[model samples]
Target: MGVRSLPAEAYYGIQTLRALENFPISGLRPLAAYVDACVLIKKAAAMVNGDLGCIPADLSQAIVQAADEILNGALRDQFVVDVYQAGAGTSHHMNVNEVLANRALELLGDQKGNYQRLNPNDHVNYGQSTNDVIPTAIRIGGLLALERTLFPALADAIATLDRNAEGFQAVVRSGRTHLQDAVPVRLGDTFRAWAQILSEHLIRIETASGDLTLLGLGGSAAGTGLNTHPHYRQRVVARLAEFIDQPLRPAPHLMAAMQSMAPFVAVSGALRNLAQDCVKISHDLRLLDSGPKTGLKEIQLPPVQPGSSIMPGKYNPVMAEMTSMVCFQVMGYDSAIALAAQAGQLELNVMMPLIAYNLIHSIELLGNTLAALNHRCLQGIQADRERCLAYAEGSLALVTALNPHIGYLNAAAIAKESLETGKSLRQLVLERGLMSAEDLAQVLDLDTMSQLPGDT
Candidate 1:
């Protein structure tokens, strides 16, 4: 049989076969992830049918069993194809359906590809179109990736930084604005700010997830619900909710669902925000980890690899570097998603091929990057306690904390004298008799200084 005639196979056409042979990057086959998604979709589809009283009980049981086998990694051997093709993932979708159908037939003691007894398209796919199924699967996969991987890793990072804040609460460091020293802040406060940023990102992620939850599954074909049963929409969504263990609602308007790619763009935007935040944090970490000899050396990053081939004993912040790269890739993916979103035409978006690719890549990359950052960077972070304290003690900015207790002119004079004479502010204050020893100590105390009248 010609490759085109064999709908059961992935690389049936010479063009497809050639593309598969040429694109050897990511040695991992394309169908593995798709098949996993397909398995979930199939389970969801069957559950939807079962709920609507359309599927035979025995058939539903068989489909569920086959889905379990695919989920447990039994059918990956059959999924040998590249995911980066330009055909809108039709072949990819069919490949998954064929694999599941054949597997389901096997469970029923029947031959593979026997569409007469059990068709991959008619039975396995049911009312789903690649348009609906592919995007739905992308959302499902993205949600799972975030819930299982990204959120936990980010939560770990927040918790790690929170603990670091508590541990370094007393260790004061110079706070910088526009890359210049501005004020003295506790090292804990700096880490707390980072933690809060990540916490806000997590909340944004949760909000983006709501967009993913609004799926277009029942919008068969061009989102007009053509060829789909009247009741199939709600049934499939309810089933998907149960199967995926996440609440998924049908798009209220099928035409809107079919014609727009805004949800994907929204997801991309959320990821971009997260990636930008990561880049900011990584940049800060890189600066803070600058040098052991001549640079800020504010905090030491956990060294994962050698900095250079010739430089001996030089450790680079590989975790931070890798995270920054991931952020860059996420930004690129966001651009791809934006381009793909623009590529949507009249009735349906034909750019799902790239949209799915970029969406999945962004989710996986963000998840993995967060996991690595939490484990390699945030977990081992430590403050240079004495160095931080020394910097804070030497800062002229601390004079603001004393200005209310001693008038501004006196405070400025004391700060000027201390800076010129290289004397501690406390020493200068007491020596000049600007304040008594007890008064100077009280004014300099961080709590008392922070609460002094007119400080806020």
Candidate 2:
């Protein structure tokens, strides 16, 4: 078919089609959450125009009503474009603008795609630029993804680990450092540490979200608000706050909004921190589930897939491995975002498109991966209690706890003798007269070791 151009269709040009066809790696179309965010921005802009008397109240009301419909799932089919394309999201902004304008026109008894009756550019995108609107939408979409998906999934993972902690609190296990036996710890303590790392990252994510709340709505082209009316900035941002029910604040300096992408860089850093934590946790989980016979076999991860095509009774820690791979990908995306942020130039950062694409992609991936890690790995995780206790019993490193009572020299001697003789540390302690049976029992109690003296 030959190209068909509607009067107000900004993305119907050949360039857009070619770009869309070229970059098909992700194949992921724009998300509904993102489209809803775009609608929210348009609604806010319309409301601002009405407040400034730049547009008629009825037109503003109509535009907002149309946007609300879209927000509530009215024109979802229209946003069938990938997020990673050329033109700095101009195509996306115009697509949304045209959809909202056409919907508003239809509400007013006008035909769809009739830009002359209700021009998308002139009216719908009255005081905005793809430059400003796209980045703002990226932030809004990111925040929404965090709230609706990432945070909750992470919380579930934390809760799962917390429950595991409780379940394995009494099972003593040998902790390792540099892949070597280091000390005695409860399996519960190990899981609790995992939960703590996730909890800390959750705080970091919330802090990163703070940077996202500073939107560039009023900052039109070049972030000067030059083409926009003087009062437009505050009005639009305020209306956006109402529409999204988020505490969005205007960028204190419009020039900074246009020139600097520090907020995105900060968000990327937070995501990198999260990815690092995931990598660490996944790596540990894989090691803990290393082998059923030959390896440490400290814990048994729920087997979702077979380990081999030919080997029988082989279960793989596929979830852990996949989670680690996703984390590595996220770290790479974070690097891309950082490099893009560094590449920002003078009055306008032309790299906003890449930044938006990577940040949104990272957020979504992190969210989905975390959900899978929680459901497939953490929630279904089972500790090999007998195996863990056996390892603990066999480890001479448990002598570290005895050091306080028996003195470091004697503790080392006991540990060395136990290792040389291949005897249990508890039996060695008693045989060496390091402590009586009652004292050894008190010291060897995992609960006693985990708590302070008065607490126990």
Among these predictions, the greatest TM-score belongs to: 2
lDDT of 1 by residue, 90-167 (tens): 656766777777787778888765668776777777888877787777777777777766778888888988998888
Superposed model 2: Cα runs more than 4 Å off: 1-28, 80-82, 404-410, 426-447, 450-455
lDDT: which candidate is best?
Answer: 2
lDDT accuracy of residue 13 in candidate 2: 30
**What tens-digit string does per-residue lDDT give for candidate 2 at 118-165?**
778888888788878877887888887787788888898899999998
Number of clashing residue pairs, candidate 1? 0
Overall lDDT per candidate, in order of appearance:
0.76, 0.80
Each model's TM-score? 0.86, 0.89
Clashing pairs in 2: none
lDDT, candidate 2, residue 70? Answer: 76
CA error at residue 37 for candidate 2, angstroms: 2.0
RMSD of candidates 1 onward, in order: 3.8, 3.2
